[model samples]
Target: MEPPPPPPRWFQRLDRRLRLSPLGVAWTSGREMELMHRAMGFAALGFLTLVPVLVLVAAAQPSSGHGFARWLGQAIGVTHESQLQVERLFGVPNTALQRTTAFGLAALAVFGLTFGSAVQTGYEKVWDLPTARWHTMWRHVVFLALLVGALLGFVNTPAPSGDVTGPLTVVVLDLIGTFLFFWIAQHILLGGRVRWIALLPGAVATTLGLLGLRGFSQLVFSPLIASSAVTYGPFGTVLVVQSWLVGVGFVVYGGALVGRLAHEGRVFRRLKDQDET
Candidate 1:
């Protein structure tokens, strides 16, 4: 593999402030990269292994997923009955199995790449190193599956709630889960070893960013979607796509902030020593 290039002169100049960013912490902490790699492998494995568990748990309840789906569809102007039909189409025993398999495979591919990219980013930052070969990436993939499975089994177990609150809660939880997944992916990509507490800062930053985006979207875009007559049509699709982009912007910015924080911390420490002298 080729040696990773050093950061450009501009980034180097801002290195102190960057340490406080997620990317900076990732870059500075080689151990974290290794942890991230391992955790990613475990997470993928967890996705496959936990499908049955999640399905079983979900199936046992009989009413959880459909309820949420129904409520979402209605809130979005999709009639409750239309939502029910969609659920039924996917819920047949055979169909559900196939859906689960397809979902698992897709997740494995999506997150495998996602975690790997994060690892590559961190590896580049810390050591000026490039990613390892596919074999190395595979090792990380396996590690991610395991790590993610454990986490889902623990933190993500569903709570039975009929109250089914607002769209904002749904959006918030979705973003929170996304942040957690990315945080864990970073841990796995690094090597499945990190201080769990180290994850909190990144998660906190990400969640806050997501919430802010949510508020902005509600204020600026919700009415446009709400006022539309088309449900499950091209107009609705466009609205959903637009909202997704807004959310994604927040997530990407949050990640960049993570990188910057780490860079900043190192610069601060170095300067403090010079000042002492």
Candidate 2:
């Protein structure tokens, strides 16, 4: 077989720089990019299941009041103007809505579970463990419950009005909530394979990454949403949301990678000491 071709000069330099930096070490060692791609695939699946549920719920409500849109805006901590845009985007006629049924809910649950399962598999791969199946259903159920709680917390907490404090409070709450969720998720999804302390770094990283993305969305997605609304109408909302999900997938997986690397480093040190003795 022919030997592989050499990497490009730019890539070689970039790789070397990554090797030198601490973050780069984790990124490379943890196979962060590859994991991110896998995560995006599953996250997309979750988004597919999730969006329909949101749409159905929104459509079932009276569109005249924009009640669903307003709820969603509160859930994500967006401003009033953004809330109106969301209302315009998601507000579907009641006549077109499908009734929520047991079968539909079951299917959504299965699809939504796949994303968490995928993340669990990714962490298992990182830790060099066999695939775990025991208690898998229960774990997914717990994850779903946690997700619902987080959403409820977000939507129920009113954003302070008419001052910078409101936005700051929103950001702080989002950060804290995300941190707690990711931290808990790391523990539950991984099935207690690693200590909680080992998971903190990645949880923190994921929280910060999410916060950064939220800020980026505020600056970038608002205009896109406005333009898309004018151009593609309601479908544009779907496009924007899917795009956001892709970013979220990367952050979620990347954080897992970071945590895995931390756990591995500790294990490596312990092994090395044993060898020396």
Relative to the true structure, candidate 2 reaches a TM of 0.76
How much is the lDDT of residue 244 in candidate 2?
69
Residue 105's lDDT within candidate 1 is 60
Clashing pairs in 2: none
The TM-score values for the models, in the order shown, are: 0.47, 0.76
Query: Top model by lDDT, which number?
Result: 2
* lDDT assessment of candidate 2: 0.71
- Tens digits of per-residue lDDT for model 1 on 65-173? 5433332233233443444443443242434444556666676566655654554454344434455555556646664565445434433334435665654565556
Off by more than 4 A, model 1: 1-61, 67-94, 98-129, 139-182, 192-201, 228-235, 238-242, 249-253, 256-259, 266-270
lDDT of each: 0.49, 0.71
lDDT per residue for candidate 2 within 42-154, as digits (tens), equals 55886766556556655654533455455555444465565677877666667545556788788888877775677677667665668887666688778766875575455
Candidate 1 Cα lDDT to native = 0.49
Q: Could you give me the TM-score of model 1 versus the true structure?
A: 0.47
Output the worst ten-in-a-row residue range by lDDT, candidate 1: 67-76
